[model samples]
Target: MLSLRGVRKSYGGTPALRPVDLDLVAGELVVLTGPSGSGKSTLLMIAGGWETPDGGEIVPRPPLPEVPVDRMSWRDLGFVPQSISLFEELTLADNLALARGGPGGAELLEALELGHLAARRPGEVSRGEQQRAAVARALVAAPSLVIADEPTSHQDHRRARLVLDLLRAAAVRGAAVLIASHDAAVVSRADREIRLDAPAVAPG
Candidate 1:
């Protein structure tokens, strides 16, 4: 559904990414893995249109005529950043509801084992719980393209598995899922893996 051709990025004098190409299709789960600072997040940001690549372009496949053109673009994309970015003032359930723009927050909370914490604010919850809530929010919208950065970093094995299962379920439901992580379990469960080589530092 989406493709990045010859994407590259740099910060100041350092090259963060170099001519990376990626393709994402419905019902597939792909993992992006590499060492720290290898541009996994950069690539994702570019894919989600949050970051402008220094070179190359993100080409999205044309949508069917019945689908509104405005809804065909980034509106169908969802992102879960490395940091848990829930609304601090809202309860967990409320945050999820806002993401979903309707009911069903309760069901998602229950599925993620977060129903008990639904009434609490993000600040009141543990990082792991907050992480799960973040994941829930991302998937709550049932977007066509899901991009997650280090989604399992804060969860235990069981919770990590739960997150993976949720992501996989999203794929089964025809959302193209791309996750950036160093976690072995996450990588193992993915349908495909793309590794970014270490970024090269530009000469002084």
Candidate 2:
């Protein structure tokens, strides 16, 4: 299971995440929900190894625990950040191959109903389609843990459901899934929910 013990983080002198604690098991989906600046994003980033906490211990689902965030090879962790990180100049297939290191791009695209857009560039697709492509890229490697930040922000109901379905499928395959989002629809579908409040500074 993925566990965080007394996690804390801050931006400059300002605090962003408190001493939050959470646990996520394989085959489960956890949703982090809270108001803006409540440190939801900070908590997810720390969990995904994208950011380091000022103090605490982070234990991955397996094969890792109490390791430094920088020392962790989080490649096994699929991530869909709040921003769509697709190559506007490259075709969808190329981007997938580059990110996933294999040929599952087309198959993932087909599953997400974006097969027709495979030959097109990210700029050529609609915002929602691009979002789906971003997700597909993350899934191509079949990561053990999937972390998405505001994944359904720009998606319509249909597309949002598709995204959630994709995450659920990943969890079914024994991947621990954690999503940080404000959308009630997304949070409601998760197997578990974690609410991160504002960061609490440590006493000297």
Candidate 3:
């Protein structure tokens, strides 16, 4: 559902992404595996349309087209970054409701096994619960694609598996799932894997 060809990016004089080529097909869960600073997150941002690539082209999923790196809406693509951006004051369910413009909050909460904690703020929940809440928030929107960066961070094995399973279910339902991480558990569970190198810009 997404395609990248010869994508490159640089911050200051150093590159953050090389000429990476990637494709994520519908109904597949692709894992991006790399060490810290290997441009995994940068690649996710680019693929999600959050960051603009310095070179190359990206073809978005349906309802989007091949376009210059800067012109992509990336927001239309569901994203869950390493930090769960849940609100401290808002109840988890309310936060998800806000994300979805007030639809499917309960269902997503239940699906993530978070229905009981709907009234709790992020600070009141365990790390894994918060992470699942983040996933619920993303899925509440039901976007055509999901891009997750370091999604398994700070969670126990069972919880991590739960979160990844939730993501896999999304992929099964036909949303392209792309997770960028160094976690072996996640990589092994992925339908496919892409190993990325440190950002290396091509010669101009």
Give the winner by lDDT. 1
Which candidate ranks first by TM-score, i.e. highest? Answer: 1
lDDT of 1 by residue, 58-173 (tens): 78732333322212223366678887778898899887776777666687788889999999999999999998988888888899989899999999999999999999999999
- Cα lDDT computed for each candidate against the true fold: 0.84, 0.80, 0.79
- TM-scores for all candidates: the values are 0.91, 0.88, 0.86
Q: Which tens-of-lDDT digit does each residue in 78-107 have in candidate 3?
A: 768787777678899887776676646797
Candidate 1 deviant stretches above 4 angstroms: 61-75
Which 10-residue window in model 2 sums to the lowest lDDT?
A: 64-73
Hey, what RMSD does candidate 1 come out at? 4.6
| True-structure RMSD, every candidate | 4.6, 4.0, 4.3
lDDT of 2: 0.80
The CA lDDT at 155 in model 2 is: 92
Query: What is the model-wide C-alpha lDDT for candidate 3?
Result: 0.79
Alpha-carbon shift of residue 160 in model 2 (angstroms): 0.7
The all-Cα superposition gives candidate 2 an RMSD in Å to the true structure of 4.0
**Preferred candidate (lDDT higher): 1 or 3:** 1
